[model samples]
Target: KDSAEVTIKLKNNRRETVASITETIAPKDVLISKKGSHPTPYDVIHKAADTSNCINIAFLAEGYTETEMEKYINDVKTATDAIFAHEPFLEYKDRFNVIAVKSVSEESGTSVPSKGIWKNTALGSNFDTFHSERYLTTLNLKKVHDWLAGTPYEHIIILVNTDVYGGGGILNYYNLSSTGHKSFKPVIVHEFGHSFAGLADEYAYDWEEIPMYPLDVEPWEANITTLADFKGKWESLIKKGTPIPTPETKDEKKAKNKVGYFEGAGYRTKGVYRGVQDCRMRTNACKEFCIVCKNALTKLIKFYTGE
Candidate 1:
């Protein structure tokens, strides 16, 4: 197909010659491999809400052979249950549609490049992303999206079959997590906060020196703040008599669940602030999301489903 981009001409003014942009389209055959393999089928694990007006989360299988498809399905269920067990998701359980896309592979584990190991996974997931050993991700976005073509999905969770304690999440893109780890449930929930609501990482890191948020501008994430502009953030959630830049005192330790601006957040030791002293976003203690995170997630759900 070929089409010409046009510019509107007003009747009061004579038609002027303007630049034209052309769009070309072509049809290409989608050929299957000589091995006679095709895209795997998907299954609806949980249909709590209708596809037309719900947040559809599709879980894709990685590093799981055909024989382990059953296990992959069970892992998908565990992830689904773990996600909804949290605060905002628990309250809005009926507003989500969970699916499991069965993209089987020939191998049973992901690539661990640091250990000189490789596997023929369906999505080509690997560790040592950007030279970080624990950072897990997949660069095969086209393949992932192609597998999800027929499914109703806005977010993706790629469940790897290995027991390695590694996972990664990108905002509105995808979440990659291992299903067999003991901390998989809590870890997936933490990563989902990033991919689903664009929450910043509350924990500080010591290894890397990548600049995250600028001190002059307000961050768009609802969980962390630099105090650049706290007008629309969790400022309203702050309790009365709670001082700004709340100190980490004995009383603060006693009231660990309070919604005060605790220093040391967003992968920085200072300047940035988190809503609470401890939360799922800050650690893997299987804790509930802070009040700020819960409220933010609630608003995000309402934005998606009007519920």
Candidate 2:
């Protein structure tokens, strides 16, 4: 195992602060770091996206008591191990390291801090925190940047022990705050798929925000597409009749009904298209990742492990 230290810079209308983040590249086991702050109720870390050396996954954990501490550690281990067990990750076992950070919280609080699969009201709304949550108080991005600068991690994954739902985003970072109601092991894996894998939401519904991706522009995601440049990813996987905009019909009798343009996706409709009407990215069914996602993940693993 090897480690590096880096500094992150955070600036705003008020002032600029720097925090140091340490990254330890590991091949086989999980790497743990000291809690950056006391009474720290949350955890954060980075993962290797497409980088050199062995570090593949990074995480941060937070605990307030011995019992919670033990459970948090064990839960993170299980989630990280399970992630690598799947395709792509399984294919690059030697290079994956899910890094974690342990933070403490006030003993009186009923729930610890960890993000959930989605809609973490406990964390105070969704993206709002990203804008309103004080930089140094919650996540000192400058420090996090410094921490990651020391390692070869290109992608980042964060873990939290509370029972509430956890969530992850793109370069913006993900949150998996705890609900303190049930075991969040499964949610950990699901959310990581989004945070670490660049996985898109597969399910569909309505949202206040209109279409996010431009249908004509085509999507960079391996799984979904606007058919603008399908050749790179799912073009080959699409069945002969698979329409440009995959269908959502479950009835086999309507197999023909399966291949047609459908609406609703990527938090919007009209333009963005998805490979299938439903997938693990969009729902909680635990569906296998679409071929494009699988291959992308596989490539990511190879990029890190050289396996």
RMSD to the true structure for each prediction, in A, is: 7.7, 9.7
lDDT (10s digit) by residue, model 1, range 1-307: 3344545433311223454454433334245223214535888888865667899999999999999999999999999999998998998888899989999898999999999999998999999999988899999998888777766789999998889899999899999899889999999999999999988888886675345666666677899988988888887878788876787755744556678888778777778889888888999983788888899999999999975
Q: Using lDDT, give the best candidate's number.
A: 1
Model 2 C-alpha lDDT per residue in residues 210-300, reported as the tens digit of each score = 4556656666566566666656765554557755455567663453223234456566665566655544565555434545567777776
Give candidate 2's root-mean-square deviation (CA, Å).
9.7
Q: Which run of 10 residues does model 2 get worst, by summed lDDT? A: 119-128
- Give the runs in model 1 whose Cα sits over 4 Å from its true position: 1-39, 206-210, 249-254
lDDT of 1: 0.84
Provide the clash count, candidate 1. Answer: 0
Question: In order, what lDDT does every prediction score?
Answer: 0.84, 0.49
